[model samples]
Target: MCIIFFQFKPHSASAYRFILAANRDEYYSRPTKPADFWENDCNILSGYLVADFLTEEADGLTYLKKVSSEGHLYNGFNLITAEFNNTKGDTMCYYGNKSGQEPKTLEPGIYGLSNSLLETPWKKLVYGKKLFTDTVKQCNELSQESLVEELINMLNNEEFQLPAPDIEEQGQDFIRPMLKEISALFVRTSSYGTRTNTVILVDAKGHVTFTERTMLNPDANQWKVSSFQFELEI
Candidate 1:
């Protein structure tokens, strides 16, 4: 399961307007690529395909709501969409088919999400949000480099949370062990584990800094780090 922790303060007078850290957990043996700007669209940066359906006329929340209407076509996913506007500040929204909740705009605040849903209160999510809150509080004290380093370190945390009682009672015999193993922010199993960690910071001046750390060779523990910075056109 993947996890994300983010704070949105678009109207803040501080150095940063938004901060996010995420981990993509998957089988180590699965084919993967590092984060980069898309070849077809230089304006978009991601490890995966940039959704071409998102038109310039429509904001992220609108597009997400359209997707939600067809949510049955895809597997369960927790999707968060944000649109940052210089004139209008920023808007963020969350939609998840698993929770059966309607798409709704989110106010400026810190939040955590995992496989289950947004703010599901999974132990790891709770712990991660607390860590994220603490990091955000010290943003003014840390340099941009230090902030990124701290967020990366936060994602690398390996402390495991005890499985919730409901999960233990409800999970199947074969699934309980797997759930326990994945309770850590940094999941490390024999085959499946956290393969990538990404940190994104968007400053109040519309400057964006994106950093990604990806495991290149899981067996040898080899990894690659990439960073990019650009000013938003807006």
Candidate 2:
């Protein structure tokens, strides 16, 4: 399972217009690559690249809608797309096919998503949203480095909460046991656990900072961190 928490405050008076923190949980033995820019498209950067055929003029939200319309062809996923513009402000949208809800634009505020759905109130999602909100409230007081550190710490949180009864009941027979183990913000097990944590910040000036921390060797507890900073062109 994976988790994402974010705050979108377009055209706000504060320094940052967007803040995002996420954790990617997977089996330790799973083959993975670190975050980096694509060779074919140096303008884009991500831990993994998905080839999507779309016109260059299509924006993030547009691409999201296209994916939503074809959601039935793919497995369950929670996708959030955003377009940040200093002049025109910003736009964010959430689409969860499992919820059977149409793609909708999100208002400027904090939001969280886990394996279930958008703002599903899963134990980890609720806890992470609170941590995200608290960090955002102190954004103006913290430096950029401090802000990143705080967000990273929030992602590292291991606090756990039992899943709601309804949630537990919805799980398959074999999935029920795994549910309790993954309830924590940071999950760790013998074979599977959180493999990476990522934080992204886009300031009012259109400056973007992306940082990713990955587990290099789970058994030895080795880790690696990579960061990239750039100015948004649009």
Candidate 3:
């Protein structure tokens, strides 16, 4: 399972009018896929390359929907994509499980998700909402660069870090799997742990910046940060 959480600010005084802070959480066993926006962005969602599009939804959310993939669908993705001054906020999000859940339009707001369902919690505990609200309040006015660092820290918060004892005292029956699930923004399930943190920001000026911090090993505490900048209308 993967975790992708972000904040979208379309109108702001910051350099990046659109600020997106997100992390991709998966087992150390899962392979990592780096983001690319410096050169060509050829992200294929469902079936269509995210770069190519021109369509409108019933509610005016312009996007092309593809239910089937040319091959097997990649299931380890929790993605939130937007269309800009390319396709209506051209925003489209897809959780790994979409057997019956159809794509729907979304208004501007903060959101987060893991392996479970889009907004529905798989278990009794889900902490994305609190993380979203807290981060937004603290980082809303920060520059794109500063905002990225702040979000990464949230993922590595020790308050809810794995193997927590406080959770156990909450009553084993109540917090068993739930404690781990809700605070799983950063996970270390034996050999699996968070591997990367990414932040993407764009502005009305057609400028884009994508910053990534990758862990060398599952247990390794260090990260190599890479920042990419380019100009695009969307």
| Each model's Cα RMSD | 1.9, 2.0, 6.4
Q: List the candidates ranked by lDDT, beginning with the highest.
A: 1, 2, 3
- For candidate 3, write residues 21-95 as lDDT tens digits: 555555666555555532332432121144333232322222314532311356533334465554434454442
lDDT tens digits by residue: candidate 2, 152-223: 999988877775554566556744667666778888877888899999999988899999999995652888
Off by over 4 Å in 2: 49-55, 163-171
Model 2: number of clashes?
A: 0
User: Native-vs-model 1 lDDT?
Assistant: 0.83
Give the TM-score ranking, best first: 1, 2, 3
Error of 2 at 3 (Å): 0.5
Higher-lDDT candidate among 1 and 2?
1
TM-score of each: 0.92, 0.92, 0.66
Task: Show how many residue pairs clash in every candidate, following the order shown.
Answer: 0, 0, 3
**Candidate 1 weakest ten by summed lDDT:** 48-57
lDDT for 90 in candidate 2 is 94
Pairs clashing in candidate 1? Answer: none
Model 3 earns a TM-score of 0.66
